[model samples]
Target: MRQEFDEEFEQFVRRWSPALLRVAFLLTSDRGEAEDLLQTALLKTSRHWSRLADRDAAYAYVRRILVTTHTSWRRRRRVHEVLLDQLPEHQAGQPREVEAGRALRALEELPPRMRAVVVLRCYEGLTEAETAEALGCSVGSVKSQASRGLARVRVLLDQSHADTAIPEGAR
Candidate 1:
């Protein structure tokens, strides 16, 4: 039974990993973190592989796991933040990456649930109903979250551009 489950899990990973990784990347906004998120989701999913009703069910289940895991990780970090001596920072990306980077940073600033809702709806092209199902919430909640998330993202992007712009007198 374990061998059978392993084979099924491997096949599922091979088939769905690319799409899952793309979703994870949107959720994480970093290549390394995205890969790690997907791996963690897959690892969790594999434990219940034999019990999953079907491939689509497994995919949806794993997506939920990924979102919840990310939220948990964020909460853990917040809890330990004051105790930590320092956090490592990475070097800046290329000039061409600036706009994308700003958008991602803005997304990162959103609350975890809002970020997940935005990624599922906008990035994944899921309908409100579909998103509600994925997030295990009502359609109304999905609508509200998506609206607020998009609004926050717009404000963040505008602020980012404003910060980078030179004043007319200084130009």
Candidate 2:
């Protein structure tokens, strides 16, 4: 029975690795950090494989671990950090890369909880109740977080636009 579960778990990882890794990357922004985060979450989730309610819901289970783990890491991390003018090597020079980078940078400014709410709701296309379940919060909290998170993102994006805009005839 244990060996069968292990084989099933391995198959699950092989099937979902790409999608889960992408979500991890989206959540963390740094590729290396994302990989580490996902690996940790997967390790934690696998320990309770037989106890999971549904084997098909492994991604959701793993995502909850990822979000909570990330939140914990953020709390432990220091506030001070340097900013860079350039994109990470993996993302540079791609189509729409500049705009996407700006948006991601703005997203990073949000508090950890708010960022998770926004990513789960908006990025993952989860509904309010679904997001609430994922975060272990009330549905009302999910709604408010989504609203507040969007407002903050809007402000940040607007500011970035103004900062990068060409003057009247400069274009």
Candidate 3:
């Protein structure tokens, strides 16, 4: 029975880790932090695996864990600056790449709960109810957060565009 439980848990991790990692990365704009966040969520999930009644709902269960854990971590951590060894090189890329970078930066500007709501609803394509469940909030809260978060992202993106735009006839 113990071996069976371990096997099932291992398989669950293997199958779901990539998707969960993407959620973690979206919540945390840093890859390293995303990995750590996912690891921590998975550790918690493992402890509760045997008690999960529905195996198929495990993904949603883990996602809820990820969201709550990230929220808690953000609340407890103090802001600190990391000094990089060298400046990052800017690459000249296609328009889509530029737009995506702007979008990600805009996402990083949002508050954590708002960001989580937007990511879960927009990026992950979860329904409002599902997003609310993952976020431990009411559906009405999810709706409001999604609305405000999207509006803020749009404003941020527009501001970035204005900052980078060339003057008329400057080309």
Candidate 4:
């Protein structure tokens, strides 16, 4: 039984790590912090792996740990923040990369909860109910947070677009 659990746990970790890391990165807005968050969550998940009956529920448990952990971290470092402008460009294609990079920058500006809501909904493609479950919040909260987060993102994107627009006089 232990061996079977170990195998399944290993498989689950491999399958979910990338997605988990992406969510953690968005929540923490720092590569090092994201790695730490993932490590801490995985460690917590491993300790409880044997008790998890439905193996599928492991992701939900891990996500709960992530939200709780992030909340605690936020309280500790309440004011320390990094602006997205400081992030270096490492995009692939010149045009698409630039566009996506701007989008990412805009995402980085949202508050942690709002950012998590957006990442789960937009990036992970989770529905409102699923996102609410993952975040341990009401579906209405997910809807509201997503709507507000998206509005902020659109404003930022619009500002960026306006900045790059060629003046009519110049054209």
What tens-digit string does per-residue lDDT give for candidate 4 at 101-160?
678889878887888899889987889999998888999999999999999999999998
The lDDT per prediction is: 0.86, 0.88, 0.91, 0.85
Ranking by TM-score: 3, 2, 1, 4
Q: Which stretches of candidate 4 lie over 4 Å from their true place?
A: 1-5, 81-93, 166-171
Candidate 1 Cα misplacement greater than 4 A, ranges: 1-3, 79-96, 169-171
Model 2, residue 97: what's the lDDT? 81
Model 2, 67-120: lDDT tens per residue? 999999988985736699986676546748888888899888888899999999
The best candidate by TM-score is 3
lDDT of 1 by residue, 16-113 (tens): 99999988887877788789999999989877777787776887888888888887877776642125577756466665678878988899888888
- Candidate 4 backbone overlaps, count: 0
TM match of model 3 to true structure: 0.93
Instruction: Point out the higher-scoring one by TM-score: 2 or 3.
Output: 3
- Who wins the lDDT comparison? 3
Give the root-mean-square deviation of each candidate in angstroms.
Answer: 3.7, 2.7, 1.4, 3.2
Q: Candidate 3 regions off by >4 Å?
A: none
Model 3 clashing residue pairs (backbone) = none
TM-score per candidate, chains pooled? 0.82, 0.89, 0.93, 0.81
Residues 9-85 of candidate 3: C-alpha lDDT, one tens digit per residue: 99999999999999999888788999999999999988989999999999999898888998888888858367999
List clashing residue pairs in candidate 4: none
The candidate 3 region of ten consecutive residues with least summed lDDT is: 73-82
